[model samples]
Target chain A: AQSVTQLDSHVSVSEGTPVLLRCNYSSSYSPSLFWYVQHPNKGLQLLLKYTSAATLVKGINGFEAEFKKSETSFHLTKPSAHMSDAAEYFCVVSDDRAAGNKLTFGGGTRVLVKP
Target chain B: SQTIHQWPATLVQPVGSPLSLECTVEGTSNPNLYWYRQAAGRGLQLLFYSVGIGQISSEVPQNLSASRPQDRQFILSSKKLLLSDSGFYLCAWVPTYQETQYFGPGTRLLVL
Candidate 1:
């Protein structure tokens, strides 16, 4: 079984501050992890993915996540938080060789950025 | 660039009403397609997926069904809408040789 856990239900921070959203996973097989963001009513946008290559994966809009196998974690981080960065974040995991790439999503973490 | 489109963007239907949602993809061929639902303040739930025309794999068994009549066209239908069916539905696709899945604009359904 594969599952992802986002440690925080919500996180609030001021602009220009470092941002961190924590996630941990449990998977029996080698897994592919991803970070996705949803702004308000918009659909989810892929942030980054870890597929056993580089542990640290960079994504769009200055977002990134590090795949830590020992801790079974993939935490999203950013040096600065823009107002535009306020959104819902989801951590996902799936078997690297799954038939349809079926993804198991975390409950979601809502980010609020204040100026 | 590959693109996926789902419509109508927002829908309100009465319970027991028949529902049909359409999704289409362009700029790619024989792409793998998926349908997922997300409830308010919840994560995405996989519903169905298709690798080719007329082939579909369902993740959740319910009143809903899916069909892929064409390579890039996917349809979601339900015999009758339920209050629990209300949610945001997304359509996504990945090229056969690619590993990443890209999503469409999504359709918000509200059942009353």
Candidate 2:
């Protein structure tokens, strides 16, 4: 069984400041982790993914995440937050061994970037 | 360069009405398709998945069903709409050999 937990329900960051969204996962097998961003009324967009090749993965729009095995975490980060970065972010996990390669998503963290 | 498409960007239906939302993928063959629903302030819920034509697997038990009539086409349908079904619906496709799933612009459904 595999699952993900996004520690924060909401995060507020000022424009030009750093941003961090925490996520933790539990899986019996090697897990594939991903971060997705969703703007209002828009579909979820893949930001980055960790497939056991790299611990630090960079994504579009200056977003990146680090996979910490000992911590069992894949937390998203950005050096500087922009007003346009305000959106809902989800942490997802998938076990390749699972049927259909089903993905399990976290509750999501709503980011509010203020200028 | 595969792309996914979903029709009826927004819809408003009366309770008990029928529903049909279509999704298609281009530039790829034998892709795995999926349907997901996101309620307000909630994460995505996987509803159905199809590995090939005429093959579908449903994840949740609800008033919804999915079908794949073509190799690149997947459809979500319901005989009757429920108030609880109002949410953002997303369609996604993943390559047979890859784990990353690409999503299409979602359909926003509102059942009155």
Candidate 3:
């Protein structure tokens, strides 16, 4: 079975400061990890994904995440947080062995960017 | 490019009312379609998924049912809405042999 856990339910950061959202996963097979952001009342937008390629993956809106095999973690980061960056982020894991590529989603982390 | 569409952007229904939410994918064929529900302040819960027309797999057992009448169209229905069913419903699609799922704008459902 594959599952994901977002370490923090909420993270507050000042505008222009760094932001970090932590996630950890458990999967039997090599997993495909993804980071998705959802603005208030909006649909989820894919920020980035790690499919066993580069350890460091860059995504839109200056967001990036590093996949650590040893740590079993994929933590999202932004060097500088913008006001628009305030949103809810989800960490998802997919196991190829699973039928239909079903995804397991974390509880989500809500980021608050204070101006 | 592939795009997913969900209708009834916002719905307010009473308990025991019938519910139907439609989702259609454009620019993709024989794709996998899924329906997810996000309760307030909670993560997404996989409700159902379909590999092809008339093939649906339910991940959770609740007061909901799904159908894929067409290759690109997936419908979620409920014979009666429960207060627990009130949440955001999202439709997503993944292309054949692809692992990435694209989501639609989602329909906000409020059961009163």
Candidate 4:
């Protein structure tokens, strides 16, 4: 079984400040991790993905996430926060062992950027 | 470029009504399609997935069922709607050679 837990249900940050959203996962095997962002009533957009190739992954919108196997963590981060960054962030884990690469999503962290 | 699409951006239905939500993918072949539902302020719940035409797998047992009649088309259906069925439904597709999935805009179904 594979699952992900988003540490924060909501996070608020001031503009230009660093942003961090934490996530932890439990998987039996080496898993593929992903960070996705969803704006209000919009489709989910992949921010980054870790496929065992890179421990530190860079993604769109100046976002990045580091996969820590020892810690069972994949935390999303950005150097600076922008108003447009306000959205729901989800941490997802997929184990090929699971049929069809079934993805398990975390509860999500709602980010609020204050300008 | 691959794109996923879901129909009836918004729907309102009464209890016991039949429900249907359709999803289609373009620019891709033999893509894996998935259906997910998100309740208010909740995480996504995988409902169904299809690896190919006429092959559907249900992740959760509920009033809903899924059908894949075409390679890139997946449909979710319910014979009787329940209030709990109201939620934002999303469709996603993973290219045959890709691991990351792309999502559709989603359909908001409101059951009364």
Q: Model 4 over residues A1-115: C-alpha lDDT tens digits? A: 7889999999999999999999999999999999999999988999999999979999999999999999999999999999999999999998877677789999999999999
Q: Once superposed on the true structure, which residue ranges of model 3 sit more than 4 Å away at CA?
A: none
Q: Worst ten-residue run, lDDT, model 4 chain A? A: A93-102
**Per-residue alpha-carbon lDDT of candidate 4 for residues B1-112, written as tens digits (9 for 90 to 100):** 7778899999999999999999999998999899999999998999999989999999888999999999989999999999999999999998886778889999999999
Q: Which candidate do you rate higher for lDDT, 2 or 4? A: 2
What are the TM-scores, per candidate, against the unseen true structure? 0.97, 0.98, 0.99, 0.98
Per-residue error (Å), model 2, residue B59: 0.8
Residue pairs clashing in model 2 are: none
* TM-score of B-chain for each predicted structure, in order: 0.98, 0.98, 0.98, 0.98
Q: How accurate is candidate 4 locally (lDDT)?
A: 0.94
- Sorted on lDDT, best first, the list reads 3, 2, 4, 1
**Candidate 1 lDDT:** 0.93
> Looking at candidate 3, what is the lDDT of residue B101?
86
- Scored by lDDT, model 3 comes in at 0.95
Query: Between 1 and 3, whose TM-score is larger?
Result: 3
Residue B111 alpha-carbon offset, candidate 4, angstroms = 0.6
Which is the better candidate, 2 or 3, if ranked by lDDT? 3
Question: Candidate 3, which CAPRI tier?
Answer: high
Model 2: per-residue Cα lDDT over B1-112, one tens digit each:
7889999999999999999999999999999999999998788999999888999999989999999999999999999999999999999999988888889999999999
Alpha-carbon error at A56 in model 3, in Å?
0.6
Q: By the DockQ metric, which is better: model 2 or model 3? A: 3
